[model samples]
Target: MTLFSREVELLQLEQDPDPGVVVFAFDLETNGMTTRCDILQIGVKGFNWSTDEGFVQEFNQYVTPTNEIPQHSSRVHHLARDEDGDLVKETDTPGNHEKLETLPIKAALTNMWEWLLKDNPPVLLVGFNNSRFDNHIILHHSKICCEPDLMDRVRSRVHFTDLRTVLSQRGEQGNLESHYNSCDGPPLELHDAISDCTAICWVLNGKAVSYDELRGRAVSLESVLQKKNKSSHPLLIGKLVTPKVAEKIGFITRENYLKFSEEELIRFLKTKGVTKISITLCVKKWRAVSYEADF
Candidate 1:
């Protein structure tokens, strides 16, 4: 009777889960505002909600620009070429000192790309005003460096989340520092790329906005660029003119620029104090546009 009754046990099999996407909050300290300017430093802090207890990875690198760091920009980030022709970045903390080593833009960007894709998980790039500024610089440099693979990967796998826009939607106002202060975040060292990235992570990690909300707000960088292109003047897209020059002309988009005659264009450029060489460049670019239109 005891042998007739048998007990069977079933073992549950556990399958490994796929790697979860990472949220990489990044910041770039640049030589200037324009895409032509160089990125002095790139700081990234990655948070993997699935596995990480806090920021799991950090990447900080100094980039040596082909151009000299402008004094105005240096004043902000404390990065400059020392008397020995070596690049140096001063620390924000008065007593604390740090060594600064630089990499060429191509090497720096490649390293950054490697770091971002290390886990082979999809990445969400986040910044305070990345949609307009940071993303553009990244895309532009990627193109300049002829990194088709990086551009393709960025277009496909990497998406951008602008914390400034997200916070604005949430009814929180002001810059990154302002938002961080609102969250009662830790003491922030402004202007340094690493500090800024950490601050961004702190703000997003705060009660005001959850990480889930940031994920929901993510958008492809290509879409954002496409939208901007649609609204921008063709010359601006082609880099025939700078934004500062465009604003000075009082014609932002191609449509507005077309409304004026060549004479009016020259007059406006003169009044705006645009350099004679730049005025010639603008007029030549305008005529080239007209010629292309004829085709």
Candidate 2:
């Protein structure tokens, strides 16, 4: 039920206290919704929370995915594209994506990771809907690049913050554009990573208002995403399970399943002959549901 979790064992800021908490907000544009999906671009911005100061460093890059950009995906961001299939920018026109010199998938992810850790004290990784989407995409690509442990390494280096959770906890709908519109904030660029990152920073800055306010609610990034548990069945879904036994039984699939709260997950594990369990994320319901199988 809590929003943020910080790991004290990973705290690098204790020795150097003056700069205050660091937040590195970033965004990702990807090709699709599945685990093996491609990431088209990334944008990052770093700032000091106490003084609300952004560091001189910012990162933006378009990446060439192994797969060509799908038409539906391209429609979301509207990046400049040519017959040669390269992303490009218009020389004298407005509303066109900047010139599309792009890095390879591995290079882009590595570069973004390096830039985030450039500071002496590590920066927290913050993202909009990161737990559900961005983090997984990053992880999948990291694995493809043969750096299977990259995300775990990052998690160990700094805390991860989810802007969506904070917004929802404060009773606002967790959509980035909706929040931006309500504040009369600038129009979001929709799927452009840099523009979206900037918009998120604006929204978070407006809501956080003070470092103490954010730090109090910050949670560990490792605790936010999918966790593995021992069971004969695969438990393959990506969302967290609610903690309790279900009042009713439901069908299960490779891509979908029920969920349990932390307590519920434990109880389900204890059930006799319970051989399988699945965790499902209901985007419409905005919560993870636990599905159990007594096979």
Candidate 3:
């Protein structure tokens, strides 16, 4: 039997108006910054910006992890305890809590897919810097817990868009916060899954008309950026380089990217002027994570 069974059809998409299109933007808070890391929370918000009709649905879930959250990762999102024996966040309890009910990784993923596939499938699957992070993690876990066929079905029907690419193409100083502030978006609870999702959507709405446009822009920008990289440095494909160094090569998995020392991280930034996984315009945080940067 195939892994995933639920598949969403395009369903007369060509006839639909721009305002009728559904765009789902999501974010993930994880125990660490890798595809192999456990997902801590997921937040998704769907809306049609053309009509400004607001969200069709907003979903958020907390997932219990099988592994303990690391000190570095906890510092970023505060999902686990630190060496001082303090919980990452006061509200983040060990087990299921009142506000955020915790579920097993597989169960949470199944629910996430169900919520996403409700009524009609989202025309676009968007995230701030999802191309290299959230997408990989979701797809990785979904393969084991959910049906691979269902995951494939979902993939076949939806288009993926990364808002970070758009900001990078704009040039000068760029990051999620600056763009969000420029758009007059509300203050964000940084690192929170749902808040990040909302912030990303608002920023996206302030610019692009639809997911198709963003996808096109991301593709064009990626080509331009990669070509520029090629001009400066030889392409380092399929080489057994250090994890920190591998990011310079392009989109390494989290497992491979995190295996570096402080010196390597510093050396990479000072020399390359950009993180391996991110450009100067878009600063890399945790595994393809984009945050504020001094550009």
What would the TM-scores of all predictions be?
Answer: 0.67, 0.64, 0.61
Q: Model 1: per-residue lDDT, tens digit, 34-92?
A: 87689889999976544423466789999876778888998888888776656786666
Score each candidate by Cα lDDT: 0.66, 0.59, 0.59
TM-score attained by model 3: 0.61
**Tens digits of per-residue lDDT for model 2, 1-295:** 2111224444424433245555777888877877577777888876664444344357998887567667687777765456676775444355555567898888888777766755534456677888777776775566467364555456546555678777777677758887766656655566788877777767766665344444445444334434312231223332233323232332232112232223344454456334465544343355654454433
lDDT of 3 by residue, 1-295 (tens): 1111111133335333366677777889987767688888989888775656346678888887677877688667767744443334634455532334578888888887877776645456677777767776776677678876666545545555677776666662466677778878767777888888787777767765455456454222112223334332212221123444444445255332332223444454556555434322212243332223332
Best by TM-score: 1
Residue 92, model 2, lDDT? 38
Ranking by lDDT: 1, 3, 2
How many clashes show up per model?
Answer: 0, 20, 8
List where candidate 1 sits over 4 angstroms from the true fold: 1-21, 49-53, 91-99, 231-295
Summing lDDT over every window of 10 consecutive residues in candidate 2, give the lowest-scoring window: 251-260
Candidate order, TM-score descending: 1, 2, 3
